[model samples]
Each structure stands twice: as C-alpha cells, then as structure tokens.
Target: MADAVFDEETNVLLSQVDIEPVDANWFDIETDFVLSQFNLDNVLDMDVKSGNFPYSQTIGDLNVEANKTETGNCSSKRFNFEAKSSDVKKLQASSTPLNTQKNTRWDVNTWDDWGKWRNDRTISAGLKESAPYVLVPPLTVDIGAAELCHWMCRFILEVRRQDGSEYPAESLRQLCISIWRYLRDTCRRYDLNFFDRSKPDFADLRECLDARMKELNVSINKVKKQAKPINRTEEDILWSSVFSLNDAACLQYAVYLYACKLFGLRAADEHADLSVTQFTFGRDDVGQFIRYIGGRSKTVQGGIFHKKVLAKDIKQYANDSNPRCVVNLFQKYLSLVPEDGPFYRRPLATKTADGDQNTQHRRLVSIPYRSSCRECAKGQVLTASRLDTLVK
Candidate 1:
C-alpha cells in the first residue's frame, strides 16, 4: 500500500511542473519573477537617502531640503574659485614692473674710477697741462678720430721722465698704444661708432702713429748708449768680494746678489715685495734646492687677461762645499732674522765718542750684529737704489 501512495504523489508533482522551451533572447526578457524580486521604490529611497538622486521625490518634503543644501554647496565652491582667480590677478598687478631702461654699460662707478686714475697718471707724467685730453664718460663726449690722433701725438712728444728727460722711443710707443686701447675699449662698451678701421681717418691716424714711432726710434738710437753686461769673470770677482766680508751688511748684500742671479729677478719691485714664505726647501733626482714661488710679475699682473696662466718656477741648487753657497747663506741669514718680518732688514750699529787732549774723536762702536726693528716698523726695505750701489 506505501508503494502505491509514493507513485501517486510523484505523478501529481510531475503533472504540476511546467516544462517549457526557452527563447533565443531569454536574457533580454524580464520575467515576472525578476521584476517582483527587484523593487524600484526601495532603490529610489536608498538613492535619495544617500543624496545620489537630486530629483528623488519619494520622501516628498525632504527632497526640496536636499536640493537646497546641494545648491548652497555648489554656490560656495563657485565663490571660492572666483575669489582665488581674483587674488591671482591682484598679485600679478602688484608685482615688480619690468625695467624699461636697459643698461648696456656694466659698472658705472668702475668707469668713473678709471677716469680719475687716468687723470692722476696724466698729471704725474707732466702731460696734463700740455695735452689736456681728459677721458670723460662714453657717449657724453664726441671725440673724432682726427682729434684722438692729434692728442696722442701731443702726448708722445710732450711726455717726460721724472728727471725732466725725454722718454725713450719704446716708452712713447707703448703709451700711444695704451691710449688707443683705452679709447677703443670705451667705445665698444658704450656702443659708440669710433675708431673704425674701415674709415679713412682711422687709417690716417694709425699711419701717423707708425711714422712718429719710426722717427722717434731713429732719433733715440742715435743718442742712446747701450749698457755693457757684466762678464762671468766680473761676477766671480763680485762673489769672492761679497764672500770675504764677515759683516752683517755684506752678508745681506750677498743674499741679494744670489737671489737676483739665481731667480732672474728684475731690479725693480720684485726684490722689494719678496717675503720669506715664497721659498721652500725641496729635493729631487738632481739634488737639494730652494724653490721660489713666483707671483704677480711685470708681464703678468694677475689680471683678467692672464687667467689660467701658471706662475714660473724658480729654483736655486745647493752647493754645500762651496764657500759662497746660496743655500748656506740663506739659511744663516734666516737664523739671524725674525720669522715674521721682511726678508731684508736694516743692520743695526752703535757709535762711541773718544775725547783726546786736543780734539774729540767719534767712532762707530762695535757690537753684536742685529737687525733693527724700528727701521722695519718704519716700512723700510732694501730699495732698488741701494741694490744698484751695493757692488759699486
């Protein structure tokens, strides 16, 4: 009887199940079951609560309140954007204005200082009253090429040495060249149209300068006497004489002579400006020597024109066995002098007076050799004049 009841129930379930064939576009069709599962009202209510749907009216009065709040937020954002843009415009208006007057010439004060120095040089050279060709600021004065040529001729003819003697041909030529350089540089800086080589006046000026230089050279050569150079025998005699003397003054003179011979130092300010620090003791494969560190020289003045130029290396070798060894003399001199003072100093001495029956005799009193601190304090050194007279 249970089997009969199970079969009847299975048959009844099968008869109630509807087995229909699905269409080709079955996913596109929305059946009643899918439509009933998704509620549009609930989705609209959720969107309104989350403020995603601005036109949602399912919550009637709340919709109007939400719209008003959203409108105020948008208005506030627009106002902030407008305010930022206006502030940017105001900043641009108040910023520093562009400099309309473009300055081509650099450093006005430097040019003015140069003008003053040129004036002083002219006065010292005794050409101020005669030539009277003052260099003013560029573009302010109109100096023609002819005028420049005339001024330079006058300068060359009238310039004299401190002893009131005429300048040598070389010196006059150099002065004229320097003056032309100054004028050319000044014209370039101020963008003036002067010293044009293409023009006839400039050509004529150069021709005149060349002709005058040739004539001056010829005249100077006729009168100027050539100086004789000291021979090796004379140099040996000088060295022996300097070495024989045991006085402090003679020792200093020996050191000066050695420095001039070994280092090729000029008879001018090179010896005057020397300090103790420039020399260094070093040794190489050859032998031991004292190295001299070269600095600003006559040809190289450490200016912009001499950039990246290496200074010359001057060295004096040691001759320990020799009586007039430069190294030994220098070391002995160093031992006698102070560390901080100049390389050259004045040797000190004392004087004594002896009274006899008829006359009183004053003589130099002998004392230990010492350099004078008072003379060094007075800025005195071995001048070129004294150096010239040492051997004589």
Candidate 2:
C-alpha cells in the first residue's frame, strides 16, 4: 500500500486524488455493493453544499504576492562556487494567454534590465596611454541601414581592445548573432519588415553576416583544444606542498582540502548544511567509515540522493600531525567544531597597522599552528571562493 502511494526506487507518487477505485469488484465485493456503501445524501449536506474542494484552499492575492517574493531566496544562501551562479531556474512556455509567453519564465522587467546591461559598452585607455578601442565611432538610429551593416562587419572583424587584444573568434561569432537578433527585435518593435529574407537588402545583409560567422567558426575550430584530466603525479605535487606548508593560514584550510579530495566532494554548493548533524559513523565491508547524508549537490540534483563516504585505512601517513591524512585531519576538525556547527570555519590572522618588509621572511620561518575556532562566526561556513584563493 505504501509502495503504491510513494515509490522510493522510482522517486514518484500518485498526483491525482483517488476519487473512485478503478478495481472495485474485488474480494467478493461487487461494484454495485461498493457504490451502495456511500452516503449519497451527503451531497446535499452543508459541508458538501459549499462549492469548495479538500485538495485546494483559497488564499488572498496579497499572500500569493508575498510567497512569490520569497521564490529566489535560495540564490542568496548559495555557495560561491567559481563565483558564478549554478542554480537551475528552468524556463517554461505557456499558452491560453494566446501562446505569447513562449519560454517567458523570466520576469520581463528583469529581462529588460539585463538587456540594458548587455547593450552598454565602453572602451578604457590602457597602460602607457594607448589609444582607446572604438567600434565605428558609435552609430545612431538615424544612420542608414547599409552604412550600419558595413560598420557592423568592420567591428566584428577588425576592432581590438585598448590593450590591442581582439575578441576571440567564438565570442565574435556570438556578438554577430546578437547583433542580428537585435536588428530583428528592433524591426518587430517598430512594425518594420527590414529583416524579411524576401527583401534584397535583408538577404544581402544576412549572407554577409553568415559568411563572417563561418569564417570565425573556421578559426575557432583550428584553435580548439581538448581538456585533459589531472594526473596522479600532479595531484601528489599539489597536495604535498599544500600539506607541508609551514604557515598557519595554509594549514588552517589544508584539512578541508584533503577531505574534499578523498571523498570526491566539490568545494562548493553541494552541502546545504555542512554541519555535524549530517555525519554518520559506521562499518562496512571495508571496515569503519564516515558518511555524509542528504546533501543536494549539483552533481546529483532532481530526486536523486548523494552520500559521500570515507573509509578507514589500515596504514596512517605519518606518526605526527600530518595534514595529508584525511581521517586524522577530519577528527581534529571535529574536535575543534561544536556538536552542531559549520564543518569548516574561516581562517584566523592578526594584522599589523604598520607592515614590515620582513613579512614574507617571517611567514617562511613561522611555525604552523591550529586555526582558532573561537574567532569563527557562530553559524558561518567557509565558501568556495575563499577555497579558490587558498588553492592558489
């Protein structure tokens, strides 16, 4: 009965209410017998008299608006992985409002604001007072279509930044496509038909843009390189230096870094609550292990569950405090953290008002110490952007 209601294996449940049982004649009970069990008079009862439903409860428009305001609140609490947004806000298409809202899930006002940002462009002077880069000295709406198209082509192919750096071929191709889209949108807005392929001017302009994009694609394909995975030697070198760092600042983050690598965990938006509450210690076929449960990482979204596990090893890396040992490092971190708090806290450091030139020399000679747990924010956790700096 529970499996029929909700299936864990399939991650699905019945959505519609079972108003009437389909297979009513079962266990010696006839369909008519089952129908007779119902109190037909209840249809006239006061409870049934109201034209309301059990499944849906009506709410005020104000409440609906208030709920909508909290829709994007998750973005604020997201981990700054790569310092970029990773939240998946899917676009939806709808009709009945006349099918005008195709892939219009995004707010129109927000889209307009972003479009303004995309349209804005500026060129800055570089070092040594170099000439500022410009695209055809800027054009106005009064400019002839032919002249505008000519300059647009010139901008796409020849223009460079103040630093004497031309746009990448792939990027320039995208820019060309965007310009074409802008032209179409503008024409549509003003009830013009300049983009009609049947028109001679439109066909010529389209051919020109298409040829330019093909040229860019050729260049892009020529320079394309395949990304390769990191080798064991490279990993060893990176981790060795990280674990052996003498500075307290380096050691402070080394523990978390080691743990991440061992458990195949991304140092970002994976764990919703990376506190002790999610941790579990148990034994498997490989012996004692630590498990992290219920973290909706990007690697496993949807209804899928992800659990990170660290198995106990027979051989320890070092007799003393070794930052490379995941088990030891995790235990140390756990001891410092409270029963329920952030697994990784911010590193601590004191600053001098008047810095000395011997700062580097002093750091080199300084003995590493444990990061002070007392200095950490009560409920705050380390972020991926900070992890990137530490890795660097």
TM-score of every candidate relative to the true structure: 0.47, 0.35
Candidate 1: RMSD to truth: 23.1
List residue ranges in candidate 1 displaced over 4 A.
Answer: 1-142, 150-171, 181-200, 217-227, 243-245, 350-392
User: lDDT by residue for model 2 over 104-201, one digit each (tens)?
Assistant: 22222223433343335332332233533333322224445655555555455554433765556655555554444433442332322344666564
* Tens-digit lDDT string for candidate 1 (1-392): 34654675465555555557777786755655566677788888889889998864676577778989989989887555555787876764433222211121222333344456566776677664454355533323466655655544444455565477665666655555444444444444332222456666556556666677687777775464432343455556545544333455666666765676566665444655566677778899989888888766655456666777877688888987877677777776665555543566655443223211111122113211113211321232433332333332
Alpha-carbon lDDT of model 2 = 0.43
**Residue 353 of model 1: what lDDT?**
33
